[model samples]
Target: MNDRLTAAQASRSTAVKATLDYPVIDTDVHVNDYTPALEEYVQQYGGGELVDALRKVLGSRFNTRSNGKDWYQQTLAERRYNRTLRSPWWARVTRNTLDLATYTLPALLAERLAEQGADYSVLFPNDVLAPLGAGRHRQALHRAINHYHADQYSKYSDRLTPVAGIPLHTPEEGIEELEFAVKTLGLKVINIAGGVKRPIPSVADKYPAADHPEVAKYAHYTDFYGIDSEYDYDPFWAKVVELGVPVTTHYGSQGWTGRHSISNYMYNHIGHFADGSQAFAKALFFGGVTRRFPGLRVALLEGGADWGAHVFTHLLDRWDKRNREAVHNYNPANADLELLENLFQRYGKDLIKDRTLDKSTLLLDSLGVSALPHSRDPNEDEIDDFALAGIESPEDIKTRWVDSFYFGSESDDRTVASAFNAKLNPLNAKINAIWSSDIGHWDVPDLTEPLAESWDLVEQGVITAADFKALVFDNPYRFYTEANPQFFKGTAIEQKLSSSHTK
Candidate 1:
């Protein structure tokens, strides 16, 4: 055994696992991409044209080439003109070469996961762009990538299971790949991009991004399937439900709105996964995807548990203040115009000194409820925002948000406490927080420390021993089983659970 692997076996994480009666499942271990092998597989399956397309992956958070020039090659003038958002550089572990090699080689990873105190791991490929990027050749590339993963890692399936990536730029493409990946490939877990970038109508009309890529980047919006999407996507969701695989996303919002930092990668990087997942998850809630499909089991990964807990509490709070009945409290048509005029007249003088009160429009604008005078009443279908969600009470919010959605969290995020805090969360429901030890990435310098650090939460009184069990085991098991009850069958986790039950 390598020195590092030996040391890892003797680490505290393994010690912590020794104390546990249940198995430890690491849901989000990443496999660093060996691009040359991937390229070879693409060349074989997709041919040279698609292989060349795969080679042009810009190595950004997603896989779009910036027209011609790479980011570093750009002159300041070009950067200012094109406005390229910062991308990740030097993202993998280097000094600990063996640890890096362990994840890259499935056999080594399978051998070492026990040292990391994990009984089984679901491997998300480090290169997500090929399976989730937009292009003519993407469907072929996605197939080639998933095929390569299935071929390369099947032997290690006893301990290490690689997740298949399904591109959802269109419902047709998503359904095609989903059928192929699950039915043909026999892959269980699936990773999906949270959203797809679509060109704005006016911007694309004049400067079509197909002709000018800059126009697409600068003038675009994301379509997160569940809300404001061009496609209904119910068929894709239904197919997922029919197949019984859990949905996992490692989506990043690197260049979106406030995160578009032209100078610093860190500014664009932090909380990006959380932000992207938040938008996608929130879209599912408000767009009524969860309400419509009660069997859907969605997990938003890498973003911490704190964000999930916050979203759950906030959902209940919003429902409390903005549900169908409560929203009418501030309806403009119901406003007491006489009382407002009296109060403004009494407290006014300075405010009214500037505008004429004869202008009821200007007076009402100053009073802060000025979108009205009946430009048009909303259609009956659009009356209540929460109508689609079917949220009659906070319990419904708990069922939809808390029960259906799972948050993929790292070990050291202090906010695991918030996810477990039933006292603070509305309706005393614990937000599902699953441990996804992003071991191969830069954040976790040591491979074996994640499980140990999670145990530290119990020692620090951040959560109970029961909460730690839920974080590392129960919640993740439930998430994996919610859609497909047979998700863990024949796997190492199933054997471990069966052994515990038999004992």
Candidate 2:
């Protein structure tokens, strides 16, 4: 075998050995574009020219060009923001290549599991959710994508678990899609964009609103929103509690327009997109979704963890004051405080009250946060310190900074080995942190580097090996399966895989 292959095998063997002891499950991995497989479905159900136009627009925004010698591929950034548009040579030599399947199923999955030593990898589509919020043929597009994914999941049932995507243009459609994903596809998880895009009539133009109350019924399938919110999602909280499904949201593709004057410029700005994800998530948390559904577990993907620590603390303080002020405003004779306390007690009865919020008078407890480890790509080197703050309180941010550093390294051996060997105090609640590879994006293809980097953190005494395993495996399995017993059962996984492949 080649040197690279040999190293990869060794890594896989090591991962398997580790998992045999701890049972590692990777919560966030991805399956890239299945357009070819779903072409038939698209032809039958998909909108034509508009979809093509959409693809062209998105592709132009991110696609890269290769030089004639096949030696170097230039990404969108390298094109000098489309400097090629002015060149006559561009049309002849430059072709926009958007290859979603750079990492094929069997090969990529096998390699990743072997490299990371994960027992199972929860797979999602890299492009699907981001595009749905555009509100054009959202339902049909989602159906076609899910059908394609279901087929792939069946093909590699042994290693891959697929989370189906649901369209939420209408509340009823969201509910229907959820039922279908769980019952027919056996999808334990449903991937949702945090906000829905609906056309709103205005004096000048019609635009989309990120937060909409009508979208909440879909929460019955999963409580997670792409962004965190306090208002306009109460029905969602109610349904989530009733159904008991944890929500997983990730950062990518905001369904927004008008931020940039240039259409192409808006699409190319990664920072703008990240900001939108952060903003939407903040809105949800401060808006009180967690307070409403305290039992709910929300997992943020791609977006790093540092901001979560800062935001959670800030929100808690705000809510505490809000509760106290409300109490003061009530008349003593009316027993307003007592009535409010009784309601709080009633809500607490159903919510999983975390110790962090026990002393606070606010109704909602703090939900946990998961961090995405830094990318393995040497080109992408900067690790955000903000993510490291996620595991600790805001006051402890400085003293506990070391812990965050230890937890988020890209080296798997250092992170996992050290975590395994470390003497962890049970009082810390086992970190409740997990790693998502953000695979299938145009950028990240393999888990080897990220997993290895995480391990390096462990080996360097940054995080304990136990925490490494929890980040990679244990927590995700518990997160999805624990919320809904029927969805995560072994039979469901196997049956879903079998059915998809047979098609």
lDDT of 2 at 500: 52
Report, for all candidates in order, the number of backbone clashes: 0, 45
Supply the TM-score for candidate 2: 0.58
Top candidate (lDDT): 1
RMSD (Å) of each candidate, 1 decimal: 2.8, 16.4
TM-score, structure 1 vs. true: 0.92
- What lDDT score goes with residue 342 in model 1? 81
Estimated TM-score for each candidate:
0.92, 0.58
Best of the candidates, TM-score: 1
Model 1 ranges off by over 4 Å:
1-4, 7-9, 58-67, 75-78, 338-374, 377-380
lDDT of 1 by residue, 1-503 (tens): 34445553488888998899999889998887687888899999868887777766534434223557766777767777767766777787877888889867877888887789999889888875454553777788888888889888889777777888888888898899989998998888899989988888988899987798656667888899986788899999999999998999998888888887667889999999999999999888888889888999999999998898898888878878888788877666666778777887789898789866654564458655545556676664666788878889888888888888999989898887999898988788888999989998999888989999999989999999999999999999999898999888888998888888897
